[model samples]
Target: TVIRNAWAGDPYPIDTLMMYMSNMAWNSSMNTVETIAMLTDKDEAGAYKIPFIIYSDAYYSETVPFADLVLPDTTYLERHDCISLLDRPISHADGAADAIRHPVVQPDRDVRPFQSVLIELGARLGLPCFVNEDGSATYRDYADYIVNHQRTPGIGPLAGWRGKDGGSIGKGDVNPDQLQRYIDNGGFWHHDFSDDQRYYKMGNRAYLDFAVEMGFIPCAEPIVFQLYSEPIQRFRLAARGHGKVQPPDAERGRIEAYMD
Candidate 1:
């Protein structure tokens, strides 16, 4: 293994100019190759070894003597394309996104995107910067590529919290044929409660009777006004000092105190 990969463990991040990803882990590592090139372009010991050491910044920190350029990455509002996610066996809102992330405007940054960064570096080195048909370059264009190659099986969502256009995702008939029918109807339907799994709650007389008949368990009267000691709801009042104790509200509500 290379020195950087040896230390960085599995799936080591190698970068442009054959540097490790960790080499660019910090600001000081930015423009590392450029600094080395400037120094070693003529100097004796600085020759070859300088760029090599600069490249090694992924594994070793002191190797980078200086940096030359740095580009600010864009915000969520300034980017597009793809993202990676793990398998989701369980999701809230009946398999809907738990939160939303919508951008009001298109990408406004003068920045090459994550994939474009790699492609840009490769182009400078005269290496195959993601080849396209008719000898065109593919790496430089992500927005177009996403539309062309299309999204992968589970990735490539620009936003996280968009509600289903009509209903929901992954809820409906369990049978394969029925599930396909639901997908045909725009990927939505009511949940299949075929199993009839029920959580215990008061006023469920039928469930209580069934439980007793099975000699399983007896239901007890639920307590009224249960002492609900919870985390003190905390928010700052403009007039209150930092970390100061303040009443929750003036609506004659319960005063919950919890100190731990």
Candidate 2:
């Protein structure tokens, strides 16, 4: 229902939205609203008033009917992706881990990985990060970006084999054959923490140190998990006319009630 939430109010707020690997029919709340809006709405210029929706899916699904553009994405086995610490990394408390999906077979249809498409689109839009000084595309594709784009000066999205020779792990120079390294290592890479570094991760100095090495956090600072959030309290205070940012009149009551 995030798409519908983005489409809330009399005039739709978003200009463009791309759905990746999502089933809109499964969207219990947003599907009907999105369908009605997309089919019937028009702008002052006689163009479709609703946000231009681009739905992407590997299989032919019920959501295809609503898309202005249907970008056919390849199956997972036919694409390259990295499960990095940035998103939901498949890591256990014992170790920081990441994995890669290497295309096992060629796609028979005109399909591409969404990550490659996004990179190309970013280049087309001339986004500074995705373009060179001469306005050429920085990285050729998602795999190229994975190998070259450093999250920090030396650290990147992948924690696996890195460095000029593909011999190092964690922090190192970009390895051109880094993807190959992952492929060779059974499609995954892991860094196991020591016995003392396994539990009490939020406060354990050793665990925090390893987390920093793996780019999980900036520093090995102990984290205090919040039970009552100050940000929520701020929203409540705003509802009572006490802050620069104020809640809408309709939402004020709900916000204030949640504060207590």
Q: Which candidate ranks first by TM-score, i.e. highest? A: 2
* Model 2 stretches astray by more than 4 angstroms: 9-12, 27-51, 248-254, 257-260
Model 2's number of clashes is 0
lDDT per prediction?
Answer: 0.35, 0.81
Least well predicted 10-residue stretch by lDDT in candidate 2 = 3-12
Lowest summed lDDT window (length 10), candidate 1: 167-176
Q: Compute each candidate's TM-score over C-alphas.
A: 0.32, 0.86
Clashes of each: 3, 0
Please, what are the lDDT tens digits per residue for candidate 1 over residues 1-260?
Answer: 23323223224333223442343434443565554343334335533322333232212343344323333344455444243122232223222221212233665546434444655555555665356445556544444333233133322222121123322232211122322333354433323222222333233455444333322244433323435423333332211333455553441133332221
Question: What would the per-residue lDDT of candidate 2 be over residues 62-142, giving only the tens digit for each residue?
Answer: 777767899999999999988986679898867778999989999998999988999999999999789999999999999
lDDT of 2 at 197: 94
**Residue 163 lDDT, candidate 2, scale 0-100:** 85
- Residue 215 alpha-carbon offset, candidate 1, angstroms: 46
